[model samples]
Target: MPWKHADMVRWLHPQHLIRSGMDALVASIFGVRADHRLIVAVGRPQPPYFDYSDEAAGEDFWLDYVADTGDGWNSTYAVARLLAKPSLELKDPNGDTHALERGRILVFGGDQVYPGASRDTYEERLAQPYREAMSRSPDPSPHLFAIPGNHDWYDGLAAFMRLFCADRWFAGRRTRQSRSYFALKLPRGWWLVGTDVQLNSDIDVPQLEYFRQTATYMQPGDRIILCNAEPAWIHAATTPHPRGYMENNLEYLQEKVFGRRISLFLAGDLHHYKRHEDAEGRQKITAGGGGAFMHPTHAPRALRLRDGCEQKKCFPDEKTSRELTRQNLMLIRHSPFFGLLTGALYLILALSAYTELGSHGLLNIHEALRQLAASLVNRPMSLVVGAATLGGLVGFADPAFGRWRVPMGLVHGLAHIACAFLVAWGAMYFTVSTLGICAEPPSPKLAAFIIPGANACAGGWTHMWAKFLLGTFLTFAGGFLVGPFVMGLYLTVSLNNFGAHSNEAFISLAIPDWKNFLRLRIDPEGQLTVYPVGLERVPRKWKATHADRYSPAYDPDDPQATDPILIEPPVRVMPREQAP
Candidate 1:
């Protein structure tokens, strides 16, 4: 059948009936909006840990299947582990919360839940946390804008929609629905676009369309904020060689699209804080530290920052000027108790070895006895080697063990060398001298050298020679030389792991991801500084007497002087556009 132009247009129309139906369903599910200043709070929601095996319905078929057999427990535990810490206190130490109230819109960056959504999963992980937050609010609340995270769509988003968007209608107009990729036009002439970058979608098309639409609506000097769950800027900053479509989209937006106007890109997911300005001048801020887990604290690389010191030469850069910072509440440590336990376990093994061998006077025996034992019962030698190897590995496994700071590479290298030497010596000795053999007298070419003959005598001598040389070398080396070497290796690995683990735990607890809290403040010029809650306050002098000032000594109970503190005129310029 030949297609007509009208038919082709219909076929290639921007809208699809099924897609529209789904959009309508989603709009109905989540009340969609396109007219307001947007504020977003990105975070990882915590879930409660449950003990399934100990429940009352232990025998029930469903319960047994879910919990008793350990499958359900494993799955639940995996998610619960991610959500164990829920409170991402993003509030600054100085106490500021007004910025949140001032913003007309709010967006959740990503990782709303540790694991993506399933029926009970959403209820257990997200709904409860959201409900608790809402309950604390004095009123119904501000409009929330959110996008799906990888975890939110774990089970194809069936449960997420049901919980977050199922029953909401569009503002005023009941029939006009919302879609995930909708935009909100704010009174401030700012357009907030929320995007979904799940597994099955392309971010380029919607983003380009958004840019085109934004250009149509936005005039010169207007601000356009694009929000995604992942920070495209940071991704590009960290990934020198970006491979996939997402990276390509990021490059295009950075290089071609966002240079003209005031555009801010925000993202979460790294569980750390990072801000980057590309060479072309665009700001990319990563506020992924919304309370799930603290990621390794990272300093901006010299190439990543314009004014930062060289990464290798500088131990720590100017702390105040870093665009990326780590903020956290609790500082947990690998309980010294674990180190004590590990030490005690090593002591016990060492003592057992001493008792077993020392009691037999093996330690004091002639070196020949050690050699005889090596050839007869290789178990003791094997056991000693095995124990030393295991101990060394355990030390390497954790860095909090003790003063020992051994590199695993060195230990592994030495062990391989020792094994190789022993094997070579053994093969040569055994092959030459084990079986008695008489070699032929040397010819003119080689003076007095004996060559192997095919007779039994030649083979016997070859075997005996091999056995003698190999056995003697191994006996001496394995007994006296390898023991101390193994012990040193063990100590090194143990100490390194112990120290490293302790340092890791402490840093994790001390510096949390700041993306979780709603950072809100009003500058003197009435400009809002909306940022991650827990960011360290940039040191600045407070105006001695400002219009919004109250007596510093005023009591908390006094109502007359309880006005919110406001900074005076000459607002601090927050760089609107960051360098790409």
Candidate 2:
């Protein structure tokens, strides 16, 4: 079965939050980052001995590149199935037909694994899917290389080094690079250099020296395709920390290391496809749509890049991205587990504030309000919880919103707290009025620790216990449904109208649409060609197939599986000397 949403990683879940904090702490204290890179320097694998530089291979050779993958099973498998195929024919909008052969060399741009780069996650999400797909293909094994992204760096790149740097056979692809980053000599005097930026955008000295050595092998008039973890160009323009090391270092590489040699720059931190071109024809492309949740391309809007490149193409476009943002209104459907978190928090807060309800019970609105107000001063812990919830929401607001986040986030948090109050009151009403139990409310002190019961009647204790259980369940269940709806609605409004939280908003939605990858070829004439291919939707239902003798492989259960399409016409780059 395709992995259910329940099995998917829930960012709001407490367990994940705890693990993330621990990983951050470890990265800070242990500082294995330097040691990990040193180990790679020592254990560097041999680069491909043969050059694809001019007639390096037959005329039919091509390569595949994908990034930001290894998350959900079905979605990852969808891209894997396409890549593993021996060949594919997709149509561009102009009715032109483009044929793509399975890449002889598979280059993973960044973040091949999600959450963390543990061997377990890579086996299940990354290796297994590709393995299943390759089993059906008749083609011989290909060469593989990958660079670590932030998620891969979560374990300080230990798992990534172990899996990708070992130079072993994996998923029908031979791991060629000895380190997390690599430099490959491609066909026709063109080189592909991939760098490791790790968690910070700054490249380590040893790794930069490795690339410096790569520059020595480059001859005059040679062109290069540079790949990095994050799109430095985009960050230069879109983020608050613009023009920092991310862009400056890339420029340093171009000016000091490989001047006028870079023909293209490729990256995939943002989970969508965007291509920008300078007037001189040099292109910087962001094609991250490799099976992760769709990020809105409409915001952080950069029509003209830092280097004077204009936007040429974008998959799902800005219009479609805006439309998809509307799905946040249906937030619970996408992130139902978020409700579990809120429900539990609400239950705890209500229990703490039980003393504030007084002898009047919840039936008396005026009296209940007075006690609730009193609890704000008397019960500091409950007030602290409510304040934290409110403050967190404020911080969650986009920093770009300026002071508006204070009001907007406070309103959002207050709305949730108000909902909790209503659930508490309703639950108490049912316990006392509907069930005729808890005629005398229990002490607030005991309620916070245990299920408080009445002691007046012989069986009043039993009656009060039943009332407590029923009230608690009702309050929690009601809060669960109400919580996500509130959160979803707030996220929807902030993102659609204010253009905020593109990454955070969609992760909650987990939309499995707009998945894409890049396929490249070096023609016999020595020109490079790129095809930006994508599918609008992933197959929701898949069936296990023994066909093609690939056991454990799957085909879409949906009778009419969607076909891939070109986001734009094939981009052809001529040799540097031959440029018009």
Candidate 3:
């Protein structure tokens, strides 16, 4: 589709050479200037801390005003949530006011407030601060291309759209409507595609479709900047399951639209800085640390590189000792909550198992412990004991035993119940012990044992203990139930197989000479053979006929490049009849 104005077409179709040429043609036709500077600002503004702070009283007070003064707007694009405090100030480095001339700066990303976009939230957290910052600026007017983040969508973005896009309707129409995604064409050779990546199901549908259509207008050598609230590339890495829309669309853009073009991606949901580069040299920058609650740290696969490395550092914060300390504390606190829940579940399961086994004859708690320990040392031996216990329980409940069987049944049931209870207790014991170990402050001696220059060892040790304990509990429980049943079933099946196969030659043959399952062979006669359940010789044409005069064969492992002509056949193209 052709744009009404030449500048508009250039801004919209930076990737399309034909469209760009048409823009030049239209500009000449309309006689308008097409050159302008473009800049982008993206940020997320919310309270910096997750929880309240008492020790930060003085710091908090200073931050309150610092937030109000709009000091965070150090960059060109004040792309931030208004609630992030300290709105972006458009000013000179020397503290001089600078008027935002037309086509100078653009605010390209983020929601203005967090959570539900209540009118109160907009006024208190966003509108008021934004107004104050604008008034303070020397030149209060600048074109802004703001997009809503998830929080803005909390209340369906009623207040946000009204506040930002009120003046410019969709397609410059007079009718009022709200949109979370839009495309902008700057006066310069720049095209900006802003998308809302809120968790809504519709984000991938309409938004991605629009982005693809918008890219059709772009030309080669023109810069296209894609702005989204969530770093789509990070989601690609972290999401355990595949969503075809995001994966396919991203692949299409990277291969087709962005091929050999200077394209940039901007996003802000992570609340921290992240830069990811792929094998193909594509880059994604996540500048989520605008002013929201910092996300808890987790082990990231990508490592930070040295300053001069070809691979850019993914996370600079992870390398800092202070950041590591904070991360360790967060990890310790997060893991135990799940551990506690699992322990409670196991306890309940243990009680149920105890009830079931108590009706059998095996009710001795002490005996059960002995059997458990013995089972660990010897596998089938434990199975024998477990089967006896089960049979005894069944016998005790049999009518032939009468009154005596009642007591026997009770004993057996109690014994089984005890075993089940013990399983949960054992799991909980280890879980609690590990938590205690982690909870205890590291001693000076223990600290010395840990790696020097590393953060606290408690987090690592706690994680290890939790995994070990959980694994042990699961193994014990699974073996207890399945071991006896599997052993008996296998014996029954084997006996049946033997009886059915009873014949003159009942014995199975064993090939002791054939050590490995399969062996490779090359015959001196130039035939290659494979021997296994059956023997087959390779076709004569497929066999290697020539060998190096100096060596037995071409050794790929040799520390030298192979002769290209020797290894590869020369290509010769002739008339179709002479192709062979």
Q: For each candidate in the order shown, give its overall lDDT on alpha carbons.
A: 0.35, 0.76, 0.35
Candidate 2, lDDT over the whole model: 0.76
Q: What is the C-alpha RMSD of each candidate to the true structure, in Å?
A: 21.0, 3.8, 29.9
Model 3 TM-score relative to the real fold = 0.37
Encode model 3's per-residue lDDT on 1-580: one tens digit a residue.
4111111011111243354345345434332222100101122221111111122233211110001111121110021212122222232223343221112233435745432355665555444424322322223223345666655655545566666555542111121213555665532234455665443322444445555665666655445446666655555543345384355655465456545443455666554445544443334555543333233222223233221112233222333312322322222132222233323333433422222111112345565456445533545533454455556555535332334555645554445534445554444344434434233444454443232212233556654345344634653554344333332232222223221111101111100010001111222221211111100110111122244321111112322221111001111111122111
Best by lDDT: 2
How high is the lDDT of residue 178 in model 3? 35
Q: TM-score per candidate, in order?
A: 0.44, 0.89, 0.37
Against the true structure, candidate 2 reaches a TM-score of 0.89
Candidate 1, 3-121: lDDT as tens digits: 11110011111233344345445433333232111211112211111112222132211100000000122122222121221222222335543322223234556656542345654
In each prediction, how many residue pairs overlap at the backbone (N, C-alpha, C within less than 3 A)? 70, 5, 31
Residue 464, candidate 2: alpha-carbon lDDT: 60
- Cα lDDT, model 1, residue 136: 26
User: How are the candidates ranked when ordered by TM-score, highest leading?
Assistant: 2, 1, 3
**Ranking of all candidate structures by their lDDT, best first:** 2, 1, 3
For model 2, what is the alpha-carbon lDDT of residue 514?
A: 88
